[model samples]
Target: MTYTPPAPAIVDDIVSKTKFDANGLISAIAQDTKGVILMLAWMNADALRETLLTGRVCYWSRSRQSLWRKGETSGQQQHLIEARLDCDMDAVLMIVDQTGVACHTGRRSCFYHGVTPDGLRDTAQPEISTKELYGH
Candidate 1:
């Protein structure tokens, strides 16, 4: 189910309660409705507002220094199901309905690597080629 925007008062309350880091950003963890973790990204106040207002997952791209709307370029959009602020109010947890893949490498999730006593190992293979996903 898609998320509905909270009341303006509620939004104001959330925005006020949140604690952004010195970089003016907070960690956002995206998970599927089934509780499967998808990926983690950073969000600034604007990004958080956009996600709440639009029900689409938006993030702050430190590398790009701009807003990064999920699935804007690739067809892998994340529709917000629910958003929760951590108890400390320093991070956010986003539950979403993911379309296509969540990982930039075309995997279902970004956490495809597993670290074992042996070493780091690839746990999941990419479903689609990154070259194709990005048209590179």
Candidate 2:
């Protein structure tokens, strides 16, 4: 499907956006200008607000139980170039000026490692190591 950038359509003003409901979870996708998907994360409204205010991707981490600032420690920050909501308003997509690697596994993107005939392999590695950034 062709992804047309989302904006406040004329009808959007009259439409009520979806609420968070009982769960504070919303799906978020990171995509490149070329329409390549980089990663997926979860965000609460606060994270969404923070992403807008700070121009940085903020995600609600189910594992960490807190906001996970993209590239906070790895320096692979995603500079929020644009944000879009799905038609259902239950998901978000972020266009970003990504830097370094965006994956904790030291890959340029979380999608670096992929399925292959030989099962799984490290198809890519970051230019720098995570330990190099945080000091192992």
Candidate 3:
């Protein structure tokens, strides 16, 4: 789906209200339409702006040191339904319509681990194989 960028006045208000961290980043929590948390990622000011502008989930890749648009390579795109900011504006919560899996490991969610007596354990299994998702 194509999304047009919002007006300059609206963009200015959003940027002005956010409070990015020392690294100029904010934690963005992505949740599915059913209210299940899918993943946690970092977003810089530019990432936030692009996400808001394009209605696509975008993140700051700390390891790659660049902007990472979710599902750009894999077909697991996350279409943003809404973007919410925390009270202090230090974090963001994104309601999204996720296509396919949200995890790079081909799982529905990035959070598939649980703290158990055996220590960290897999709480869920991948719906699709990573090789199938990434075509590796």
Candidate 4:
């Protein structure tokens, strides 16, 4: 988190030591400083390096076939405070200091929809438009 060594070295060490599943992907959860779940994504080695280099959230876009930089177009950048790998090294927890909205829908967090004790619930609605954020 505090120290981001050169990519090649870090990648080599982690890839060689970390126990990755067959998918070669790691689950990553984004959280605020106060431990609020903001969102979840996947991170490949490339994404990890990108995030460390830029101090922003970077995730692998399986559908898009590319790396997705959080808030690039939406101006909802997450300034990383720390990145922690789980004990098993199969998952990551990203603690960040967010700027603007974290959600593409102009919400503070992406976990707006929730399943409560009563079952599924639409906890919140979009505060702004995707068009406004992405400029379609």
| TM-score of each prediction | 0.96, 0.78, 0.93, 0.82
Which ten contiguous residues of candidate 1 have the minimum total lDDT?
7-16
Candidate 4 per-residue C-alpha lDDT over 93-119 given as tens digits, one digit per residue, 9 for 90 to 100: 889887766777777778887888998
List the candidate 4 regions with Cα displacement exceeding 4 Å: 1-12
Cα displacement (Å) at residue 43, model 3: 0.4
Give the TM-score comparing model 4 with the true structure, all chains together. Answer: 0.82
Note each model's CA RMSD in angstroms: 1.0, 5.0, 2.0, 2.6
Which candidate leads the pack in lDDT? Answer: 1
Which candidate comes out best when scored by TM-score?
1
Please provide, for model 1 over 25-114, each residue's C-alpha lDDT reduced to its tens digit, 9 standing for 90 to 100. 999999998888999999999899889888999999999999999999988999999999999999999999999899999899999899
**Model 2 segments beyond 4 Å from truth?**
1-16, 19-22
lDDT of 3 by residue, 9-70 (tens): 79768977899989999999999989999999999988998899889889999999999999
lDDT scores in order? 0.93, 0.74, 0.90, 0.78
Model 1 regions lying over 4 Å from their true place: none
True-vs-predicted CA distance for residue 113, candidate 1, Å = 1.0
TM-score rank order? 1, 3, 4, 2
